[model samples]
Target: MVWPPSLRQLEFGDGFTVRIATLKGPPSLQQLWIGHWCDEHIARVGWPMSLQQVFFSGNFDQPIAGVAWPTSLRVLSFGEKFNQPIAEVMWPASLQQLSFGGSFNWPITGVVWPVSLEELSFGDGFNQPIAGVVWPASLRQLSFGNRFNSPIARVMWPVYLQELSFGDAFNQSIAEVVWPASLRQLSLGRWYDQPISGSIFGVVWPASLRQLSFWCRFDQAVAEVVWPASLRHLSFGVCFNQPITTVAWPASLQQLSFGDRFHQPIAE
Candidate 1:
């Protein structure tokens, strides 16, 4: 079947098998989606060379050890049912953003990550240890999945990381973590209610931090905590009913949001 020469995006909802040496995908295709029960060996050869974004969704749990990832691919997403081991997979060098779906929960200590990756996120099933993992230098935004509660106190976070988010299960101590100087955004998980001021040496606040979020169950007191000088946005989730009257609001704060349960009055 002949496809339109100008076709730039394509999606195959049914099972698709890329025949060896006879792939007939769109020449200028920039986006491709392979959905539901796709043949795991679809990578027998290679995808369209011009592909910039690719998505694989539903039941693709096969090993991708020697798959030839598109060299020009910039963004790749794996959907909910994917849960494959990727320790031996070669990631595309051109990839900048990647996201894993709900079922992915592999230990990535031995995985070779792409050097140019800027954004990476995991889904709900991830809960692996990551203390000694060396993150990519080019990573700017990173987030853990819902089940990730790994101790990251000793993890060497990327020096240039600007944004970091944790999953709902994260409740680790941060007494020894030295926040990266380049960090701009941070999000604490739903169950994170760590006492920052109670730590022997209070958690070091990154001077460049701009945005901070506390998820559903956070109700920690911030009265004695030192606020960052550059913080502009701060938010508390649904369960925050803490008294903020004695808390020192950052001078640089531009927006502040409180949860529905917050009954504390702010002094002008």
Candidate 2:
């Protein structure tokens, strides 16, 4: 089918294999989401110069070499099955956000990140130690997936980081982790089953933190967990059956959300 030249977004869903080589013209496509059958022919097509976001979830087991990607691309995402190490891929310099899926288990310790990157996300299979990785200085947000069990306490977090997230399997205590002072939002893994104990209280939270969120399976006594005075928003996910009566809520807390399992009543 012939697409119009003014097309801005294109999504190739399941059961459809797009052969870009057969396409007639370069539509002004800004976003491209491809299915599993998309092959190397994508690089051979005359992509629109206005293209900015590309999401490829194909069966790319081998390295994606010599693909002439659009220089205007800003966001790139790979599906769970794309396991090729990205160390050899010539990433576009204009990229600001990058994400990997569960199939990506490659180590990127020595890989150089784009200087323009602002956000980075890892999939469930990514267990590499990011402590020694040279993160781009411009990075402000980072996230980890369920299978990522790396010890973040030893990693040197970026000074400019404002948001951080952990996966369910990240069971390490943050007692020794030096959080960045610029952090404002923190999200704990939904699958983290450990109780919130002294390991959490031992760490000194950054004064800039304003939002703190806990995920499912985080059942612990709130009395033992020290609430940071700088916090303004607090949230708990389902399966968190902890009581709040014995806990000391910080005066700065402006909002509070409880899960269905928490049956304790709040005092006025």
Candidate 3:
């Protein structure tokens, strides 16, 4: 398919070539989906006519160097062998969702989340550090994997965060995580390391939290399973033989699960 220099919409799949010169005159396109075999070249997407979604997949023979564009992008999803500089990637102010799960790297600088972003998900193989990112104010969900190699310190969660998940290999301390008031579901799973220190759990949790699960090493027993009064689902975990006494469960609890120590089913 021949691409007009001032093209406003372009979608190519298989046996197609997208040369940098194909996109000339700085045409502002609203949608672009490239799933073809193209020559390796760096090109700017120039101005987008309110770009809403973009998808780049499959193996582009040569390293597609410096392919950055889409200043008005709202949703960006990348897949397959994408060895490009992520730092050069720019997101539009109207961006609301971002899902990236491939292999790419750029200089260790920082990421600027869009003002309107609501959801962010990182698939397996992402090892970038989101430590100093200024989170989006309207974000509701942030999901990531253990590939984030840097230690997370302080985070300014959106006042509306409701669901958060960190993959098993993640080793950062949750001591500094300040849950937002609107948070309802929080999960900290499969992490390498024994019993998280008491001081770690000392951080105040969202009073509105309904579901809580700790699947990592709890080398010691928690004297109290402080399940939020609004909590309906609770999961308590202890090391294989770590002893624990009768937990003070909330009457509001509808379902509960305990590990090996409490071999019996949780009472209603």
Who wins the lDDT comparison?
Answer: 1
Ranking by TM-score: 1, 2, 3
Task: Evaluate residue 115 in candidate 1 and report its C-alpha lDDT on the 0 to 100 scale.
Answer: 95
- Model 2, CA-based lDDT: 0.78
Q: Report the CA-based lDDT of candidate 1 relative to the real structure.
A: 0.85
Clash counts for all predictions:
0, 0, 2
C-alpha lDDT score of every prediction, in listed order: 0.85, 0.78, 0.62
Deviation in Å, model 1, residue 222 alpha carbon: 1.1
Best candidate according to TM-score? 1
Tell me the TM-score of each prediction against the true structure.
Answer: 0.92, 0.82, 0.72
Model 1 residue 2 CA deviation (Å) reads 3.3
Error of 3 at 46 (Å): 6.7
Query: How far off is residue 108 in model 1, in Å?
Result: 0.3
User: What tens-digit string does per-residue lDDT give for candidate 1 at 1-268?
Assistant: 6779899998877566553235577779899888676646555755889989988877666667878988998999988888888888899999999999999988889988999999999999999988777789999999998888988888888999999999889999887887789999999998997777755847788999999998888887787889899999999998888777788889999999998899877773
Worst 10 residues of 2 by lDDT: 194-203
Query: Ten-residue segment with the worst summed lDDT in candidate 3?
Result: 60-69
Candidate 3 TM-score over all chains jointly: 0.72
lDDT at 152, model 1: 80
- Using TM-score as the measure, name the better of candidate 1 and candidate 3: 1
Ranking the candidates on lDDT from highest down gives 1, 2, 3
